[model samples]
Target: MFKTAKKLFTSLKFNYFSLFIISLVAIGLFSFMYDSVKQETYELHEFKISPKTIRSLKTIEDTVKTEQEKRRIENEVTPFYQFDEEVSKTRQAIAASLFDFIIEEKKANIPDPENPDKLVKSRSEQIEEVRNKFKKLEKEEPGLRLTDEAIASLLTAEVSDLTKMKQEIVSIIGEELSKPVRSEDLSAVRYEVERKLRSSEAVPPAELQTMITLGRSLVVETETINKELTDKRIEEEKNAVEPTRILQGQVIVREGQFIDSEIYRQLELTGLLTNQSSYKPMIGLILYVLFVSAIIYLHFATWRTDNYQKKKSLLIAIAVFFILVIIMKLLSLIDKEFDVQVAFLFPTALAPLLVKLLLNERLAYMMTIVTAATAGIMLLEGFSAIMQMEIALYILFGGVISIYLLGNNGRRSNILRTSLVVSVSNILFVAFYLQMTQSTYDLSELSFYLIAAFASGILSGALTIGLMPFFESFFGILSDMRLIELSNPNHPLLKKVLTETPGTYHHSVMVANLADAACESVGANGLLARVGSYYHDIGKTVRPNFFIENQHGNLNPHDELPPEKSRDIIIAHATDGAELLTKHKMPREIIDIARQHHGTSFLKFFFVKAKELGQDVIEDDFRYPGPKPQTKEIAIISIADSVEAAVRTIKEPTPDKIAKLVNSIITSKLNDGQFDECELSMKELRKVERVICETLNGFYHSRIEYPE
Candidate 1:
């Protein structure tokens, strides 16, 4: 069952599908966190303004207050009035015409004492004539009629009094009509005209009463309300009242204070009332996750590694990413429940340190960004958006520092040193941000942040140190530290090989030097190549004398055995070394080097010997079992191994001889199709050849003999 599961997991389809599932899980976790913080809230009861002041949590305009203010301003606005000059002129003309007609009638009807021939009428006839003329004039002009008594009183007056009264009444009517007269002010204006007429003794009471009646009719409302102007004034007042704005982070209600209507409204506006449900948060989380996933995918697509290593690297990165996210979420929950300032205490740099140590640095940096973003999302609930961003940047700065300081993971103490550096950097960053924001200089608050920064760094180091081994072991990752540990001469496997096959050990060391130099020149992993070379010949320990390197005084062990037996013994070293390395739990990369360094090359000497002895020896039967080198380091090790063995046989090694020997060995390997599976380009192969030739030339340079 375990083997079947292993096979399924190792398959390409299964690995990709598993990656997809992991991505889905990551997005799902983020969405879950978003929902936890931004879920729907509902107010159970209504509230009103009574005994407490109501403040707003979020900035919003008070539409209710604005509307009420508009109404009040509208009520205070005075109605607009306009005077009609045409109405006043028409009324004056009618009054003057009435007086003129009365005077003319009086003149025509009065008895003439100087001329008896003239038709002189009595006072009654004159009054009747004036009444008849008034009736006619009333028909022509509607508001000009008067009573017979008023006409008689006007006729009995002296000519000068009559003229003065006519002028006075006409002037009074014109004066009253010129002023603004609303419908309600008509009677008052008529009374004012009667008062003026009564003050004058030149006019009789009946005439004054008649003049007052005429003034009432003449004082029609000349001014009307201008609705456009009145409404404009009210609108201007409404606009003048500024909208009330509530700032972000402003306190909505104090503790133990009654909730008011405006406070409740603000709570609703800020989504604190919890009555609204929305899918935006969930959608945003999904989009954010997808963006991160796309970046991861792009990194993988662009990475230059073998399929197996690429799969492993991706899996490790995903695992680290989720682990950091979980830690952030946990810290967020604690911060929310305890109301403590512990959110910054999260060890955000832990994942980046682990990734950098156990995986590649570029992948580590990518995971650092992802982890910081996740931390920001987690801290968004209790802090303002600006604060959340600052927290995220804080995490990013610390993570970057950890990655940079921990680049060389040769010793375990580097982790602690990196933590210290990260802590200092975090503290400095916090100090800078605080100073820029001009926050209160409360020592307690500053100390809390400083402590959190220190704790975050130290905790990150501790966690990374503790968890790195597990990740390396579980993922079968061969980190630099693990490689250094394996390279230690005190290791049991290396000690055994040193004791059992001392000559082979010396040969391995020489080969390691050559391979390390060649690999370093081409930008491959020099340490890995050197370490793999150290254990490549461990299988030679089982039969030390059978190998030419370990044989002393040319014992001719191969001469005593048949060609087939010799080939089997020789080929067994590759498999034997692989098995031993695997048993010792060495990295797969080093084990692969042990298994593939020989690369199925034929044992030509033994094959020639067997053919001369009349034995039908198949060439394939004399080859070492090999999967070939699978990386540039392993491939360089294969070439270096052959070059070192060949160069050791040279009696008088010269620079020209060493270069020829190195080129021959590389040519043989190329002809044997040893580098087919790896991603080494032709240009890189040429570079490797040149580097190996140069290194071998230096190793076997001609030396001047000292005269002894």
Candidate 2:
């Protein structure tokens, strides 16, 4: 079962990106199709029955023939189809009859003087008046060449012979019932008459009523026909198709159902589809994963070691980056009234954030690129071309600065501040992008986006915080937490070891100096060795007087005991040291140095004299635990232990004697295989032995007057 599950996970790993790509394409297709139908919702699908199928369908249904599918050529398609024709016909008929009504509608909707008929109507009046005056002029001048001035001159004198005119005229007009006006002044009189005709308030009378009736019929009939056609397709389908004739199926829509070139453009306005996203996601996923992995691969490649720790960190980083992307996915799944392209900003902006805290800046740079590409390809609505490019640029610019300025040396707020600054910078870039694409967007909207970015920044800070401890502990990574705790200057064991047994503490300090120098020169971690030395003999503090160095004013415990008893006391220190360190909860590395520093070295003087006395002394009882020093510090402490003690035994220790003594101690420790488990090579050990010799020689060189 386990094997099967492993194989399943491996398969999921191989083509997970394919699933993502397919899903994105499906969403694009569905959204475009749904939006197209919704926005142009006012239009209806028309179904015209073919002449052949109409009668057959009607005959089958036992009803009159009204409709069938595709019944005629589209020339027969109706007036919303024929809306232009209807408009033209209405324009013509209205001009002949309800001219005033048509003029009002024209004034309301269309641009300046759209109907040419109005101009034609007004011109007709002037044409009729000129012809009438010219005819009268022809009677007077006998030539068709009579000027309009002469025609106008003949006509106005004719109106004065009316009784109505005489009533308005002065009493002097009563002499001939009307006095004739001057013939040359007829132009002014004729203008006044024509002005009254054009501005007349009386409505058009009964003779033009048919034209009004026809115009009204055109509007009403067209509306009725359009409604019929608009509804015909669904109605006919409902009536004609029997349930048994149809296929049983789910509501599956196909690809080209949405991508019709005829209406793709108009469909996009409703927020459905894009021309771009069909295969972009697959491309993006490949690039994103590769880009992120490349960062991990480079850092580890810098070191020659192909160790699991480096590979494990790489795995963790990629997992974290991908997990953040998934979180963004879930966030986008939330319903909002608008497209939050900047929700994408959270993930893009947060990538560097996670990388900076969890990994390094070089990795952060690569991950930022991944973030930008993924967001641009996935989260965005696929309209603006430069969103990915701009976001990427901003992330690099701001994120690199954040890593540089935020050294690995401050409080967590350094990361927080870096996130805040990166988010702000990214928001600014987003705002500029919004302006470039949609030039008329409100500036206040940018304020809201910036605010959102700040919120994301806070979230990024929080996420980095939340994940830090988990990453450190799960990976067993030695990070700032470990460093900070170690640097506390008040670790309990350190304090107790210092206060109770300052002599052993001072010895441990000198050993740390010797070990640190040798460790560093050979390319090992020196600080680790130094810190280890400070606490290596902390067990000696528990029984301070039992050890030689801490027995300042006390008598030697071993002086009165037999040589065998002295050997037992001497061998007991390693075990007692282990016990004391274990009780104090010191690290195992220190405990190992305490217990194994003596290795199986016997009580040399006691074992020799016991043999002379013909007494039986078990050698194993005198030996320390067998697994000796596993590192240079451990082995160095082992040798330093005997060297420090043996040097003190010689009262007049000269430089030559100190060197001889240190060399002999190191050489004896080496020949005994006491340094076998340690990583210290012979060459390095030889150097350590020399350093110990030199350091002790300097201490004893000027103090030669002292004697045992």
Candidate 3:
């Protein structure tokens, strides 16, 4: 009655949605109690500049730009102004000019009151009034005074013409000034000197107007250039800083520094915060909420991960998930205190094991993604890049162990072996990764880590083993052990099949051996193949005498019946097997194997024999309703079926005769379209033939003793 109730409840009303909502709420409530006001915070708004600061920066940019344009203009028309280099040249030119001045005048014998080198040097620096500087005479210094006798003593008849010399110097200056500045050359000048010149200019309004005109043009062109540069700079700044804000600013988080609704309302009223541009912790809040939502999504999502149940298995997933994330979070907070590396080894090894236990090996592999995400975030947060490799190796180690241990069968010994392998695998992986990354790890610490990996494997295996019974009972999983138990001769159904249809039961055993041998030869699941063979004819137990094999030669019932009725009776076993397997909670794959064993092939000999005996015949009526043999095991069983029945028909068989019969039967099965769906290669078929021949010879051996 409890079984009926369980079945009824499972079949009628399993509310997955309600279960998901409840699971999430429970997880959330539990997590909320432990979660503090502060969690992991990502800074997005903190780097943001205020509007006033932005405007000040714009003003500064304009001033700098205007200064740059004036400088460019100064440099453009003249193409001859720089900082220290120009000053150095000015000093050298003044020295050279003084030598020229002395040579031209021949005033070496006479003691000049002033050194013309100092005068010319000072005058050359008069960038604002170069014309006026040379026209002035200094009276402030006593050094400028000269006696008439002394001035006359400086004169010489060998004097060069000062007028001609001055003319030559002026010509050189004109020649230098006549050269036009290239556009690119004018755009390169020191900004400070130009600013100083602009501030100190005294007269020459016309010259100032011309300079202003040039400055305006340069300002227009440079404004465009500066704007391009500013845009580019903004992009470069964005690229360098790499601004990213996630979660779409839509979700409301229950944790962290959230702006109170009351505070936001007041700020909105005062226009201190706008809806779009206001910094209200929205980005960070939404991102946290998204992270939380994704956690819930991964936990509650009804993903059909192979054998795992959605409604019941969610809680285990949620527990493991939070344990991983929370451990990561806690480790991040206290890493320095604990002296842990970027990530601890426990979680990486634990993730795949947990997935393998609660779900499938495929999902166990899928755990690598979550681990990678976890490692990626840690790397971004400041862990060594080497942590990623360690995490990857740990994930792969766990996956390999889980797949090797839990892929086909979950046994305690396999689990132990898996633990051993995981221990060794983790140690090897760590060794290689550390050597490559040049990490310093103590051997004692590594041994402890491997022990932890081994323990995790055992724990995951235990969990999987413990939970499997419930899932198999609940979701009707047909494990090989269950099938094997069901196929025992003592089973109620098998016993019924044996006593009620002894001939069919005997036939099924032979079929099981043949099918198992065929499957093993081709590297298929031999156990499933064997179990499927036993139950493939369970329907024969329903109506034993209807089948020829179970009739025990009691004046053939089909002899009096129409060919259609007889063929129906024969073809009915396949359909009957399907219904029984389904009703008894066998897996769909086994049901398919049973249903497709016969395929849509005609009952050739029986139909032809009936027709030759003068009965009206329809070819379609004699055919078995089928989906055909979809798997190698089923197709192999079909060929074995024909072989066993045909071999049984041979009244007196010898070893040599049996070999010929077995080869003939296999050839007929191949030619009769029985081998099409199996993907059976020629090599495998030959192997099957050899085994069947050997088995058949042993079963029918009667050798002469004189030969030996």
Q: What does each candidate score in C-alpha RMSD? A: 5.9, 21.8, 14.7
User: In candidate 1, where is summed lDDT lowest over 10 consecutive residues?
Assistant: 49-58
**Tens digit per residue, CA lDDT, model 1, 1-708:** 988966766775534754675677666666646744464454434454333333433356657767777787778877777777887888788777777877787667756679865657877888877777678658866755577776777776767767877788778888888888897897888788888888977676656776666666666677877888877777777788787555665766665566767667666665655456656667877777778777888888788766667777877887887787778777776786654367778885797888888877898888888778777777765425322787789889899988878865536788888998998998898788778887576777788889998898999989987887888899888877788888999989989989999999999998898888888887888888888999999988878889888888868798899888998898899999999889888889888999998887878988998999999878887887788777888888888888888888988888777878878878888888889988777788788888877877777677798999
Per-candidate local distance difference test: 0.78, 0.52, 0.54
- Candidate 2 Cα lDDT to native: 0.52
Give each model a TM-score: 0.77, 0.44, 0.53
List the candidate numbers ranked by TM-score, top first. Answer: 1, 3, 2
lDDT of 3 by residue, 113-192 (tens): 58633333322222223223212321221122322322222222224333333333333323332333233534432232
For candidate 2, which ten residues in a row score worst on lDDT? 53-62
Which is the better candidate, 1 or 2, if ranked by TM-score? 1
**Position 142, candidate 3: lDDT:** 19
Off by over 4 Å in 1: 1-4, 27-250, 259-311, 336-340, 381-387, 408-414, 701-708
Prediction-by-prediction clash tally: 5, 6, 2
Residue 129 alpha-carbon offset, candidate 3, angstroms: 27
Candidate 1: count of backbone clashes, pairs at least 3 residues apart or interchain: 5
